[model samples]
Target chain A: MTKKIFPSWIAVDWGTSNLRLWAMDDTANILGSAESPLGMNAIAGDPKLSFEAVLIDLIEDWLGAAPAKLPVVICGMAGAKQGWLEAPYCDVPARPSDLAKGAVTPNVTDPRISVFILPGLCQRADPDVMRGEETQLVGFMAQNPDFAGWVCLPGTHSKWAHVSTGMIRGFRTYMSGEVFALLFQHSILRHSVDDTWDDASFADAVRKASEQPTAFLHSLFGVRAGALVAPVGASVAPGASVLSGTVIGAEIADVLGLLQPGENIALIGAGKLASLYQAALAVHGYRAALQDGAAITLSGLRQAHDTLISPPQET
Target chain B: MTKKIFPSWIAVDWGTSNLRLWAMDDTANILGSAESPLGMNAIAGDPKLSFEAVLIDLIEDWLGAAPAKLPVVICGMAGAKQGWLEAPYCDVPARPSDLAKGAVTPNVTDPRISVFILPGLCQRADPDVMRGEETQLVGFMAQNPDFAGWVCLPGTHSKWAHVSTGMIRGFRTYMSGEVFALLFQHSILRHSVDDTWDDASFADAVRKASEQPTAFLHSLFGVRAGALVAPVGASVAPGASVLSGTVIGAEIADVLGLLQPGENIALIGAGKLASLYQAALAVHGYRAALQDGAAITLSGLRQAHDTLISPPQET
Candidate 1:
């Protein structure tokens, strides 16, 4: 824990497996921050008893001696039906900035705080739902307020939202990350792959799969056959890379197919996942500009707070 | 265990998860049949001890004091490199009748039995392999003596063999079945699908996949999102059907791409799997003649026996 400072308001990003919060001044700059593995999976029983108690405890020191109650805007899985509040989804052909239109305020027993959960977005025609990515979409909208391009947020459920002017024309979701993780970690293919990856093989595989997407299943089987001749207990980087490329490439092909001739792609994610998407996108002739995930998450939360529930001035 | 019977020859289909055996008279007519959970996975330590002992024990009653040693033909995973005996794969672009060219005789302690493990087939260019399916291919050839078309053997690892004039020109292996099993049984998609399948949805999904072959990840995620509103505890038949169709359709598309003009398709499998494939194949303007799997396996083994190991006096 770092030295605590008094803050005007708070922004929370609560997902299935992790929780992150930032204390901010009236000007929207982060004053202090904290995080925990306690997320939706950690919540138990009633929100008033379990959710509020844990949340209050986490921000207890930061709340020290501040007489006025602080306002909080939250995003992510915390708004899921199983989360703290069921903030119903706003169906697409809609903008992420309008997510607040479907927001729901959770009842918190703690008089020191007020919480509003931002709703996620959904696509009815295809039947897809995203929780926290809505905020990132907002954050993306905030960063490029007048931008007209494709904003891709890659993750377990990677999302690609088409933005023109200020509204989302349409968006599609791909479980590419989920496919890779599931195949690598739990499938029979697990025996033939490892954490290692090869860039050249990955790029080559991307092209192969995108060209002949029907060959997906065979390429996966190839990993199993390829692993046999590898050195005993050796790294399966080459195989893993090929499999990863195949999965991502198929995804890129699908999303890119939905793109207009020269629609630019702007990526709103961070770290290795973002880099992988960048490399994958580059192979397809689209250079995606990386948008820092943390920055956008905070920015999105700040935007939500400012628009929906600005803090009251203190004495 | 039925009444003990003395048989002139025996056939064994030993796979990774289960084992099936048949006792046959000199006329290639079945005398008795049996099955057990003991399979290739059951083999432990030295094959001479664990494999042969369990196998002999399984058929000790059938052995019944016959003067001449009984000849036994074996197929499937039991002949894998890691099986009871290392029966090397016969390289292909060759006829299934020539599979015996790569057969290996496993040394057995029981003088009552002379055991031969059937060799599987392998492809050099693509580096793909199959053990039991080769026997099925042999079975297929037995039924359609002069067939020149495609023989699809769908299962855990689905195989499509391009057959023309008594030989397999080339074939490809797809892990679509494995993908569905791994995803439905072990991955996060488990909660979102079930055993029940909807024909309409399945057929529609098959068409969609065969046409696009790229929007696969979205459809998988659709299963998850769709599960939320499904009837209480009701099986996700519709979703499961869609997924199964997608996987199988992709496979069909890949194999069909290899076809020259308008060729026929023969499906060699049994029961539900065969019917499901039948419906999927029908969607793509091809009506596959379904061959009984058990019969083909037996007939193929019988042909192998008659050609390579049958007694001289067969009147």
Candidate 2:
């Protein structure tokens, strides 16, 4: 008798504005990857039908002749109230096991396709919450068994989590990125700097922010005057840098002040944003280790899938 | 010999999105105030012509006279690069004396009119800047001779100023109000709350924010989830309050942390926004006194006009 082997399940991290998909073997090695702009927000109503069409089309393009009955697990904003299938929120101090055991409704369109949706985690005492990053945090925990302390996932809305004993003890979020975009794009100071950061301006802002953190907002208005009144020349990069640094630096100071000295800081995100956070942390005397969010999500999805396929004894 | 006295001077605060005109008597008491949707931005080109037309139309109805000419001092974004005439910027720690000594250009269409367009202020070391608020700040300084420390002007783009020894030494702008609007009107959290904040929700948010200042963004996400997962009869006020509190509280915390302990904080602006800033400051152990924005602007404009008309001090 020949035994049949289904390689492994797929992992998906779909958010409000973007989508990321990965195909991994049983060992969680990613064999292929795909991305699209069809975020949940773009396909909220009638998502079941729309998502199926897009998913099927993408899968056919990627796997070619591969069948459509493969098992898959998804996380992030794609499972929110407005997502493809409203995956209800899971309460926090949530763990990998908790997320793995969380409830999920079947995809209405495809009964043959077994899909597991991860729920966002929320705190009971405070108004704090996390959707997609919790899954990535679980993946990070799976990779580093003894990891503890804070993990900051920076993006449009950055999340800072306090993890201990393999559970997300607590977390906070900062609208640093959004604030930066609005100020730079929509506010009066937009003309202060031409869309890029000047090294001198950036350095000065960082230093000033660190020193006179209270004067942050007050200092922001200086950008416009510096450009128009003082005739700072065409190089508004310094001004832009200072604006960016002050906000980010203020966030760092707020976060660091909340944490004790020598607390471990892990940064999980991608590209320039992650680097900026890393640099800001370093400026404030914190050593933040980097982690790729995509990798962590894949690992986390696999760990969650394993928990479901192999049910362990509950304590 | 008869000394001439201008019957009325038109005080205009022309911003990007709204135009406010005040008919002021010799003493600068606003005899009548009028607002129109015809802002500087609405007039794509020939701002002087467009502005003159709008002002003439609005005033003709009130004054019952043919509107050929009127002495006016315009401030705010109308004096921007895209404004009627770029009023050029002034160096920071700007003072009434500096504004008094600032330059003015006559209207291109009506050269007989001496229009004093107020200049924005900029900081030498940072990218921060401000425009119309300089006039308002000057007005505040005129009223309170001993006023020093931080003056927070709340608006779409909130400004925090360091006023010492009658000089606007430094300031910073926070996009807090604008962020609140964008998040509630445009971002993912828009659907979480109703248009207004109820008592419970507002108080709860303010309290939570004061306690856990860092968890602001995380708390914001809870607004949506709370509405979804909570009891059907659950009040949406808490969710909205949480959102409001998080942004406002975080801003207050950032500003307070930026300033020295026990420094005097003055809340300057008009209406509900100023009151909100005052409330936020009170929450953070600072009693912020309120100053009327319009009154300040008028005083500042009067001072500026007086200075311009006075003879220059010889070296």
Candidate 3:
């Protein structure tokens, strides 16, 4: 019979709601991948055994019967305190490569797999924390070694990081996305907002909110009040765009103070939210170069894995 | 038996969530009062019949056997388009007396009562509307006729009106109260906030948010983040006061621009919320005189009632 070859390791992006795994070879190329909704939050009845069972259930085929111990690298909320095993945060003003140094290996009964959970980052003075995004940041830096300015990773909890000389200086998080969702779905404005999008209404709201940032509190109610008094044409709602614009505009106006005049901005992530951020930035005359978050996350995980295999001094 | 005495007219303050009735003398004194949870929003089936049923259920005894048709002066959401009858809005830059002119009398099945639903005020230029609060505004002005600055009525949807020379020149509304409740109980910050009260934290947050209003978005997340990495001493949650402070402070900062350097401010309402607004203003070196919103609502209903009893021109 012809000899068979197997993948070298596995990479996992385990967050609160989803689990994604990638099989990689010695060349760091993806050989195969698998995904499941069983994230860190889904583990029950003895976390260690549950996690091991879930992992084995998904990738048991790749493990083969009595195969050599495979290195499984993990990132995101799986390293949280309430997660499988805590990999404490690496403080700010540190290199992304520092993630591996703080990573922790959890004991596994399955002889074929060895798991390593990567550490997140934390800023003590300002009190901010990030899990999976740190890996993405490292990947971005790995691609553009000379990049120095602001990197915005937009999501449910949007993060804005300041980077220079291969070090993450500091960062701030905004709950704008979460707030928008809450207000749109739960607040009194719910009666006046829906999935509608109007570019003109959005642009006007962006400008007005930027001009008078303090007016945000007052203007928020205007979305409902405006729709009540003079709704858009035939539709009952005129606020869907205005609500989104005001939120994004308020975020931009606040973060503007952190940027230098004409500073370089790289926006990471994909889909409609990222596009909205890009459009919002353009509203302020700023052009942001977009980057793919998935690719960067993989690159960052590989960087950590490489570090784990060979210490910098030994290499 | 001596001739039994009864109220000449019944004053009603039927809002979105509650229906309040007061047996008033000709001088606007409340003799007997009754209230029910069935406000305009609670009416089911035929609106006219449902509303009449709810009103008669609560105040039927007041309308004794063989009573004459008593004037029932009603205010608030009862006049909303979706309520008993659509009483259109009275345009702003109007006198308190204007509410009665725009009032529409809804036909009632009961011959013992003559119903008049007072109209709410609307600002056509800026597109703002108020149902019950407009009555409270008129009441505030009635108590302090010389007061000509800003009237801050804080509630679920807070209203700020600019009054000068016995006319409401303009006004704005903020959803600060609603936003606070949502964030405190529904958002991610819910995990880090509760009913805990910390005056120092509240005041400090007020000062910071006031000085940097644009930072409100970023600072909001900081409340959750701050709790995570560095929680308050011995408490898992340290954000209750900060959340309230940030919301109220942002409102104060935004409305500050609308006021002159030494403008007078009258805050209408009761309980902890009103106190918080008062404290937030003091952080900016402004003192807001507190007024009882319940008393003011009654006074406003009386004003509208007086208007209905005797047409200003006819009187």
Candidate 4:
């Protein structure tokens, strides 16, 4: 009996501040996972260096006894302008196939390693763009073929995309995480509350922001004075929560306001961030579905790899 | 004629992070001025030491030559809950006379000094409050008795107040300055530009933010990605300008949106901050009247001090 040897595929999602890698079987089940701090930002100036070196350091034990040659598909800021190699931006209303068909540049120093780089997605309507989330969205769609409407991936630059019939129609980004961090760390409000968001305060802020949406800008400044003048009573958590909730509520309101009524919304990503978006959407009277970000990215990378191996038959 | 000697009033605006002193005649013209880094924050927890030592060190020569019993009216965060003394907060919609009527406590160890600490102003709306700016606003109103409108004092926590019928009707705070610093210093957008604001970018971001106001949240995240992906194209001048303009523009849009149509706005501050507020207001189709912050604070302090010395006649 002849032993059947299956090809092992690797998926990598590298961003500005962090790097994540996944090892999967031919069927795309996760065999192992590895991550590192060696993000694209860590080695921006030098593009010729192998990102694989960092990856190998993180997961050499996982690949124990495996052959040196392995096929890997990479996405995100790793292919950005200052990333390991420039993959360029794919203009808007982009597709999964657009990413699959994008260029692949082998590491100049290592021929055994084939690196398929993914292109970023951009739109002209609002000049909105994304470098890696599109692949995750594709992966998300592959798992739930019937899923449609809006998919929101919350993060430093949170993305809200319109997905229908397997195509990413359009999307927008919100700097919620960065704004929250700025207010909490650098603003006078930093003196109030503990590190984490207080639930009661957050809920109160969400309610206030939703009710008086127009006062978001005016309310943000209160964070500082509230702390200075009334520290004991004025918890930074509520003030920050209010500032964050107002800005985010305003953004969600603006985005949803533009959409036609009855447009479904799906919340992606993980933990507090995704919950915040989900809560914001709910506050606005929208029923949004939730998706696991890790699952979406893994599925998306596998689908892209499969499509590349065997081109889909045209309808 | 018996030579009349006017009581020398030593005005000190002491706060957590700064200390400013003014030697004034009975008429309130400045004779000599001094400032130092010995703000309240610089000496918060130490009880054994006093700001008096730092004050005397900075102005020993002037103090020795001037009256031995000069009275000082202190304002700002110097009298906050954690300040040298806790002066407490006065409820908002406060009048110049009301501010003057606020309480002060003499220094425990210094019998030669009569320190009248100014109280902060608090509002029921969002329970927002402020301290030093109220005194400054009082000074502003004292300087321009006929002026009435929305007075915006831009800083770490920008304050926007409605001044009508000689009273501050309502006020709001916006974390514009802190947001600007965070985006410039810590975020990925730092490399996109210098501190200079380009007219074109400022106008463009303001216009964009005004039209799609929610974009402010998303555009903030762009600061990071912009630095990483398109650092070369992100015009440093325009980028910084846009970052500031976007926050200010969003603020204006929210504040204006809350107001009844055709409401006038006035900006009170100095230098770049004042100009930014002025330009932001203009983008929203409102021409702001400018007021000097220093002049206002000085005038307000004088008015408050005068009221403390004189009782109002019953009307």
Measured by TM-score, the strongest candidate is: 3
User: Model 1, B1-315: lDDT tens per residue?
Assistant: 556688889998988878889999989789988898877876744355466777788788888786888888889988887788888778778765578656788888878898889988777666578888888788778778888778999887888898888888777888888788877887677776776768998998788777766677777777777665344686554668877888888788777777887567889988888888999999998888788888999988887777667433432
As a TM-score, model 3 comes out at 0.89
Poorly placed runs, candidate 1 (over 4 Å): A1-6, A45-50, A60-70, A107-114, A146-149, A195-197, A228-238, A309-315, B1-8, B25-27, B45-70, B108-114, B194-197, B227-238, B309-315
Candidate 1: residue A161 lDDT (0-100): 83
Clashes of each: 1, 23, 0, 13
User: What tens digits encode model 3's per-residue C-alpha lDDT throughout B115-177?
Assistant: 989888888556689998889999988888888888999988899999888888888888889
lDDT of 1 at A61: 81
Every candidate's lDDT: 0.80, 0.71, 0.83, 0.72
* Candidate 2: C-alpha lDDT: 0.71
Docking class of 3: medium
Q: After superposition, how far is residue A66 of candidate 4 from its true place, in Å?
A: 14
Tens digits of lDDT, candidate 3, A98-141: 88888899888988999999998888776688999998888888
- Residue-wise C-alpha lDDT for candidate 2, range A183-261, written one tens digit per residue: 7887666766575666556656666666654444445655555555445355444667877887787667666666765
Candidate 1 overall lDDT versus native: 0.80
Q: Is candidate 1 or candidate 2 better by DockQ?
A: 1
Clashing pairs in 3: none
Per-candidate fnat, comma-separated: 0.61, 0.29, 0.86, 0.51
- Winner on lDDT (1 vs 2): 1
Expressed as tens digits, the lDDT of each residue in A1-315 for candidate 4 is 533333376788888888888877876677778787778878674666457677656555544345665667888888887777788777667667877888466464444456788888876546567888988888877876676677888887778888877788888787667767776776666665344555566665666665665555665655545554555754345555656676577667657756765567777777877888888787767767777887888788888787776679755
Looking at model 2, give its docking quality level: acceptable
Cα lDDT of model 2 by residue, B183-257, tens digit: 777666775767576645665666666565554545566666566556567655545566777677767776666
